[model samples]
Target chain A: MTDTWLTSLITDTPQQGYELAITLSRRGVKYTQPDMDTLKKLRPEYANSAEGLTAASHVIAVNFQTVAAANNYWRG
Target chain B: MTDTWLTSLITDTPQQGYELAITLSRRGVKYTQPDMDTLKKLRPEYANSAEGLTAASHVIAVNFQTVAAANNYWRG
Candidate 1:
């Protein structure tokens, strides 16, 4: 439903964000770790604060979804 | 799981950010609008950048889940 939106949202993150990848794999989900190039463009504010990582966390191409989960999930 | 993380993530936003509320309902999801107090503490970097509103879009307590989805969902 949100093809264009998804395209813009899709991005990568630093290895530091890979912790999210490890967490997701444990929960039975499919995802890829974003490369450094993409992570550089990412706004650090959205990255995970819980793990004390300066780089942006996981990133992907999401279709139509509510912001509720993301809203809370991004917080530290 | 992540009870401490969930508590920290839950927050609020200005009425302008309520647009996310409408999106979630359209998608058959349940969510709440955060009070201004909660939104204030929210780091602006995590707030919805796509929308003109500077306020945080949405906030809720989330259990252990894949960060991949939230990683993409939070952008814009």
Candidate 2:
């Protein structure tokens, strides 16, 4: 099976997010982050760190599926 | 095979970033989002869009590997 990985920062309307999520699901991809509070609860260490705090403020809280995918996106 | 995905905002030293990258690589996780300029070059649409601009400023340009994994982390 093709590796399903993504590394794009998407910031748009809830509609857009929902649409993307749907697309991801159809492709066997999945959304990561839940609500903000829950994220904090999950990553307690990061939850208390500066990175965590910064992530919260900027909403940079999505992870990539694979390093190659992330590298490609980052390199592009 | 088990799916490998991520959905966490990581902000730390370049060392930490590198370390994480290495870990991801070993696990077959890839990193997306090249350098700022390159990213802009690749995603011109997002580059010109407000969301793209915002992502640039915040550095929230990573994708999730799997929905279940992302959901687990966010929920935790």
Candidate 3:
């Protein structure tokens, strides 16, 4: 569910569970708690997979960083 | 600057400032201060247009809300 939502944020379309997970992983996206919960629900094996962790870090560095920066821009 | 970054987040590609402004408008994305600043820099005309405000609200509703929810999940 969360994967689909996140994928839609990027792709503007809903994707299958596994496909979205793979996509997020391949993109090196960070995982928020909701994302992790959703991943565990949808595919527990992939939730903590090597690829997933890598993607999570990447997401934090790239996407979340941007979001945080945007927030900072507003707070200031 | 902000629009391009946000677009890159979604498209994974950099787009023309004008093009990205139009795209975000159509998508109904919400604007953070950074987004507004970037939009003003790229195309001030579009920043407060009906479409832009709508998009900004939409973005906040759909995207920011998710991010906030994810944050809450983590905080818990």
Q: What is the C-alpha lDDT of each candidate?
A: 0.27, 0.36, 0.34
Model 3: runs farther than 4 Å from truth?
Answer: A1-76, B1-41, B73-76
- Model 3 chain A worst lDDT window (10 residues): A9-18
Query: RMSD in angstroms, all models?
Result: 15.2, 17.0, 17.3
What's model 1's overall lDDT? 0.27
What is the DockQ for all candidates, taken in turn? 0.05, 0.07, 0.02
What does candidate 2's lDDT look like per residue over A1-76, in tens digits?
Answer: 3465545535333223323433453243123553567545665453333333333323322323332233332221
TM-score of chain A of each: 0.20, 0.28, 0.32
Model no. 1, DockQ? 0.05
Query: Alpha carbon lDDT of residue A64, candidate 1?
Result: 13
Q: How many clashes in each candidate?
A: 1, 28, 9
lDDT of 2 by residue, B6-73 (tens): 33324234444544433432222111222345323344554456854564444322333222232333
lDDT score for residue A22 of model 3: 41
Candidate 1 lDDT score at position B26: 23
Candidate 3 on A43-70: residue-level lDDT in tens?
Answer: 4343323232222323322343244333
- Report the C-alpha lDDT of model 1 over B1-76, residue by residue, as the tens digit: 2122122222132111222333332232212434555545542433223121111111110111223243344354
Q: Candidates sorted by lDDT, descending order?
A: 2, 3, 1
TM-score of each: 0.19, 0.20, 0.24
